[model samples]
Target: MKPRIIMNFALIITLYSALTFYIGWNGWIWLHTAFGLQDKWIFGVILELISFSYIIGHFLKGIPFFKVIGAYWFGLLQYAILFLPLANLIALVLIYLNLPTTTIVKWVGAFVLAAFIVLFLYGSFNAYSPVVRKYSLAIPKNAGKLTKLRIAMASDMHFGRLSGISHARRLVREVNALKPDLILMPGDIIDDDPEPFIQKNFGDVMKDLSAPLGVFGVLGNHEYYGGGIPRYLTEMNRIGITILLDQVTNIADSFYLVGRKDKTDRDRMPIEDLLMNTEINLPIIMMDHQPAELKQAEKNHVDLLLSGHTHRGQMAPNHLITKRMFEVDWGYLKKNQLHTIVSSGFGFWGPPLRIGSRSEIIQIDVTFV
Candidate 1:
């Protein structure tokens, strides 16, 4: 790249980063106001977010020795951003309602929030990587009969500098350990741009995956956002994972996996056609990037549906709002015999911060009794 061009790109990046931070702080202020809203509890949280925000500015710049301090500061920042002004409003309302916090209670609340700030940051960023959990579900006798099945699920790999080969290796190491019948990556393996990351890391890590039933993936909203669907789809294909674009594939003889294009995609698959022959009754698992279209999964009588897009709000109180943002926030939910599991995701995305929720990869075991 030319020197002038390189300088220009850096300038653009700086501007974009500034915009992101501003939006994050602003959104969080309102988010905290909307939630985290207890008396005194909210008051302590607001102060911390400010300190941490400053820390983040330092860390991103490679300000040596400031990293750990930044970590703590960033955590407190999260708390404050989500706690203070919101608590003030709640307190005012309480006062009007003839309820006021006692002095001792206020002191205790402050102490607790201070502690919470420390813990949240440790868990969110400084903490060691989490072990992925494997789950087993027995075939319900009421269903009349069953067949053996297992699926591995992971999402939100992000695939940027923060989540490169080493991270992918750690994750694939876990995936191999599960010995799942099939591996499924629902979406967001690459945060926004899949090209650079795919060229950098995915080819090496994904090529070595151990699952015999094969690996399949679908487009996430970011896949659409970074470039058009074609380039991302082509890139994921080059890495060897099949892109299931609003289509069904019979992984094994007894079950079918239907993968839908992201709903936000202009060219999302017509779901009804994918569900052709509902009478077949073979166990069916559907994979779509976002959990937004859950009704279709239920209406199709899909035995199981898997998705990840919410990132479980990634930070505190954000998940609370995330629930309001989408019908499914995270984890397992059952509706009439159909099961949907949304993975909080395997890696962090933009902020590299996860306040309220932990990242996760899901291993599921299915069996016939």
Candidate 2:
């Protein structure tokens, strides 16, 4: 077999084994220990089947039914992550209280399942219905010709089987209602799948979206992962979005908007080179997919930087990981007169759920000082 195939198979097996082990731990406590079922094989088989379904769904994502099943599996994984530690803690407490093993298992099992349900429901609602997060910046008076500019920005929409055309339409409507002067999308607008948009012609819905300064965007890593950057760019342009790939433009002569290609692109232009020979007096707004190389942005004197690759960890427990990885994983940060806004995301990537972070479209109101 080819080396690539061998590597892929190894990766899949490793992931499947890991998930099975995690789910099996929960199963042991809830099934045999709690309900007095002695058939370990049955529980083991159930976990194996669940993991198999999840693994298969990735290969068959083009099929809508499989995608739905895959979404459920992903959601199960997240819920398990949320409850496993709590269940373990409950088990310890019960043992300390001198409760019978069966009683302890039963109560802890029930508690864990109930908590999972509540959390899942709350997370689902939070993910599907995004709120508008607002921020204001006082710009230096000499920075621009405009006095006040309202900009609505969102990133990491990740529209696919889970977050489909309806989600896109809702985002457009909500953003339009805000009546921002300019609409900005940092990156990851598509979730590595161009088929859904192609089949549904979701771009038509996007045509309804309007902004006087025009809707401009930069590429996110997903755009490349989803396949056919040229095709995706064509579609985006058709829907009235001007994608800026290492390009700069003056929005109605008010300020400069520089759209940088995603960091994931190895051949992407350097920030310093992009700024060279450019007017520095105007307020410079940059749309970079990932919030890395902060010093570069500061060194370039970028007035504002917007991004959304982190998704603020997308779910609980993992949100903590993202927080630690990025200087400003979510929300707004101002340093050395340069402002950065990293959105959690306009939509989610998997499970159709959000635990620790919020799904938001940020509205940044800038008033020249």
Off by over 4 Å in 1: 1-80, 83-121, 124-128, 139-146, 277-279
Q: What TM-score does candidate 1 reach?
A: 0.68
Clashing pairs in 2: none
For all candidates, the clash counts are: 11, 0
Worst 10-residue lDDT window for candidate 1 reads: 138-147
lDDT of 1: 0.69
Q: Which segments of model 2 are wrong by more than 4 Å?
A: 1-19, 28-46, 52-54, 85-89, 92-103, 141-145
Tens digit of per-residue lDDT, candidate 1, span 1-369: 899999998997686456446434544444344455445445445544443544454445434234345444544455654565565566566667776445333543455466665766566552127457677775442223236667788887877545667778877888888887789999887856555575575777777776777889887877776675576666667767898888888654657778888887776766677788544456777898888877877877787888898878876677888799777778887887578888888887544567667767798887754
Candidate 2: 10-residue stretch with minimal lDDT: 49-58
